[model samples]
Target chain A: MANTTESNLPGDDVLEEPVPAMQQLLDNPFLLLFIGIAVPTVLYTIWGVMEIVNLPIAK
Target chain B: MAVNRNFRTCPTTGLVFHEPAEKLMRWNAVVAVVALLVGGVLAIGVLLTRWQAVHLLQADLFYQFLTAHGLNMLVFWIIFFEMAILYFASSTLLRCRLATPALAWAGFWLMVVGALLNNYAVLRGDSSVMFTSYAPMGAHPTFYAGLILFAVGALIACFVFFGTLVVAKAERTYHGSVPLVTFGAITAAIIAVFTIATGAIILIPTLLWSLGLIEHIDSLMYRTIWWGFGHSSQQINVAAHVSVWYAGAAVVFGAKPMSEKVSRTAFLLYIFFLQLASAHHLLADPGLTSNWKIFNTSYAMYLAVLASMVHGLTVPGSIEVAQRLKGYNNGLFEWLRRAPWGNAPFVAVFISIVGFGFLGGISGVMMGTEQLNLIIHNTLYVPGHFHATVVIGTTLAFMGLTYFLIPVLFRRKVAFGNMATWQAYIFGISMSGFSVFMMGAGTLGAPRRHWDISFAGNPFGYEFPATAWLMIALMGIFGVGALVGGAMYLAITVYSVFLGEKIQTPDFATVSAKRGMAPAPQPVAVGATGHGAGVGAWGMVAPGTFVLALVFLTSFVLYYFVNWKYLSTVWPLK
Candidate 1:
């Protein structure tokens, strides 16, 4: 109902349900939270141990 | 909610400010500024000592000040402010009561105590190990203890934020999805949890080592794990500041991101790839294979970089769309030209976006590149690049929000409007120059922490090019000027908060009425829009923004290859 000239888009006024998948992901903060925490724990932190554990002990 | 649940509606913005949450935010922000003051003082010593012209502090004291500066500015000041931002994003934006105000207060005090204790150790003439605190060069036990405590406190704050979100959801404080700004804060908090946990994992061992409980902390492992904390701290800033950008656009122009899904997808990329980009710190270190380095730096890092690039385009592009929608359609840049240039919040946010992109974004990509990072690693360029990102990008955006918060949150008319506008430009532009000049010196071979650029006392001293000295001198001047701008900002904020005229019986519409203008001219904020259904001369929603982005890309391409050319020239090929 804004007459401020910016709410002119076709879909700006009323958002359609069944939001797009990426948006659905954004909408679910918990899922994003799970993925955000999990991905790094796997690839960066746990995998990081693999990087150094295999190195030959310094003489 | 155990804490006070009183809510006061902001007359300016109409968002209800939870009383306890507002108090928490004000205190954290106040403490953050105090930390900035301490760090800024140390920066003067740092700037003078490293300038080669001044050489103010001796080597030991220089390192001490630098250590304190790094911790206070990068860790304490930033994270403390971020805690406040999280509260604002959740309890404030969602119009909900804070979940656990008691826990938040406990976290705040713990953070404060830890900060004071760390400064105590550093200034007591022992923990001059610098920000990295790499193994073998041990600091005082208190230093490690303080950092551990602070990390724990920040972790608690992050959880409180999450809990508040749950409270909002359970209570149905907001309809449909959380707003984009709140979502951005969620990203930041998620990243903060990761950063702080990573810090705890490493710093706890470091604390044990400092206390002589452990025989040795492997320097390699320590460096690797520390960067997971150190570098990802910047990732938190990236998320937070990008949110500030979106929030600013919404408040100022009623602008939404051109595509909310695209922006959120970009954040998803950050979650997946950003921390891995921390491997750039380990690139030059021995024992890491070329394969890991190449994959992490070139491939994974670029994806993270892509996320930032997506934000860079959308933030301004959305603003352009909003302006065009308001009928600023005379030319490609009339919208930009006729933007709310006089408003402090608008100027600060706009300048932050452009400076972060052109200065911070482009340079960051070049420095993150596997091959090119070697050229600038361990040089002044590291600090210079971060100055752009953290100071220009993050701090400026925070300042912009502060300007906005003054009128709305504090319920005071911001004092010295004209001076505030100039303060934005002064701080942004001067800091940009200071960073670039430091990078110029770094490119000419200035070492990172060395007190003297000339290496006057060393017997086997190698002389840098003449241009290096010039670069250092220029940076010093610009750095000092930037400090003055920072001082101005502090003065303005302090005065406005305490002494500015109060708004009683607040009618937000009265300002436009007083100005005798049509209501349409005033930027009455609607929520961020996702759909763009119009056309411009360039057959796009935001042609002017596209032009600006093309300029950014062109600069990035040119600078990137130029670094490559510089590297090729210096390569010791057989």
Candidate 2:
């Protein structure tokens, strides 16, 4: 998909040149994926453990 | 090889807008600036008191400061800004003149007078009962008087909006649909009616209490009703924030959501379901029954959360579509590449959304939960979460919008363009850093209002969390960022008004163009254009979004209906 505007990219009409660093990061979606899942998992896991600790054992 | 010009730009202004509508928007920005300054001062004072580790005044005075700060910043500043922005966006997009300019000015004065009286009461030591004026914490007679006056002023503003709607309707300017931004605002205004009404309900009695006519008001009752006002007022903020996002995306980058209809529906959901969402605030507070809390806080919040989730997905979904269309298609990275990252409004909106979604959403959900809220309720975490979302998210977007809005509104040359970019970065980074630190301190169990952490007789002689202190001190750096950024913005605005280059703007172009006429474009973007493009697109679904806003509306209605069917015989309301 192209930008809705008819005007060309001003001055520098550089098309589809991949920036190395961004490309590298994009290649590994797992990094963001890991952080996303790991973070909430840790937090919620802590919450679950706390709940378990606070639970009363039936006699 | 070439596309038929889907959009046109005027050679004179280098953009598109109607003249009168632009003028009205400019006036709105001017008033907003005044409101922001007043609110900012109160906020700065509060922040200083928190940061300096010294009580500037006694506890009572401090309470007054806190009260004044909340009223000034939260109610006066944000609402006034929203009103101005809302009017500009709605009227411009609809292509109509303000139904009554006199009514708008009247609304502005009413709010100004109300704010002035409220502040004056606080200064006089007449009404420092804090913003909520929770019954027995009774304010001075003057304080209640000011509140009533302010509420009245806001009501008048609402009426002025109706006037705009009437004008738009009668003139056939809107072409059978309200713009998305205006539609969201209508919902916001609808919620505001509830918010202000609840505010009036609480303030009138509190005012009576201050007058000595009423012996005493119950704190519990006052708080319950007060939250009705307090909670919903924030919904107005939430709606405004969403509206700003839409506007900012469109203006800054020429981005439009894939489906205006879906986005508009999300906003309407807020109107129907926002009042019930307030229960989340009281989840941890005592006095409310567990059952009441569950229904109002937990169950009620489910719909609100769903609403947020829908938006959480949909807004970005729209952006993703926009980016895709822009030909960023290097897979996922292609979208990122194609986004208008260079635009200040674009960057600010993105950063705010990301930060609010993560930090604000995290703490908000945790605090609203029945079980998790117990640990962090009333802690510094509460403030941290709110500031992250409301301040960084909403306030930053407003600032970003203003960059374009001020130039167009006032028809003045922006004093320092490059400096504005740096200012945005500094402001965004610092606020985010500060919020994270504050939230961390909260988790460590640091109390919010203790001037010092010193402990005289505790069994554990350690005064407070050392890490908390360090984090808070670190937050001062961000405070500097906020101050400097604010100063830069102020300087540009002032310079533009007095000394910047002047340009000839067309007469009545804003309203006339909105009415779909081939009108002369003015120097700057009007309310519903440029920074508010997404909002304009969203306007098409104004009437319907309220009916089907998915964010909180669905869960809210479902919760209400379900509970009504099952427990109506036993519940308190019945």
Candidate whose DockQ is highest: 1
Model 1 C-alpha lDDT per residue in residues B1-574, reported as the tens digit of each score: 2345456656557766667788999999888888988998899999899888888999999999999999999999889989999999998888677878888899998999999989999999899989999998999999988988888888888889999888877655666778888888999988888898889999998888889999999888898889989999988999999999999988898897888778888888887788777888888888777777777778888998899889999998888888877878667898899899888888888878888888888888888787888888889998998999899999888888888887777777788768888889899889999999999998888989677777787998988999999999999999988898888888888888899888674344321111111122223467335445664566788888888889988999999999998888778754
- Over the stretch B1-574, how does candidate 2's per-residue lDDT look in tens digits? 2211122233433543334445545665666677667666665666666664542555566666778777776777788777776676556565445555566667767777777887888888767666556667666677777767777877777666666677666555544346667766776666676677778877787777777888877665666667777877877787788788877766654556546656755654454455665666667655565665666556656556556656655566556545544444344444555666666667778777766666676566666766666566677777788878787878887878776665566556666667667667777777888788777777666666554334335677665667877766666556656766666666766676768786565532322232332233345643222222332123432212232234434554454354334333333543
Screening candidate 1 with a backbone cut-off below 3 angstroms (N, C-alpha, C), the clashing residue pairs are none
Q: Which stretches of candidate 2 lie over 4 Å from their true place?
A: A1-59, B1-24, B52-61, B453-462, B504-574
| RMSD each, Å | 5.6, 14.6
Worst 10 residues of 2 chain B by lDDT: B1-10
Q: Model 2: which docking level applies?
A: incorrect
Could you give me the TM-score of model 2 versus the true structure?
0.76
Q: After superposition, how far is residue B332 of candidate 2 from its true place, in Å?
A: 1.2
Cα RMSD for predicted model 2 = 14.6
Each model's lDDT comes to: 0.83, 0.62
Per-model chain B TM-scores are: 0.95, 0.82
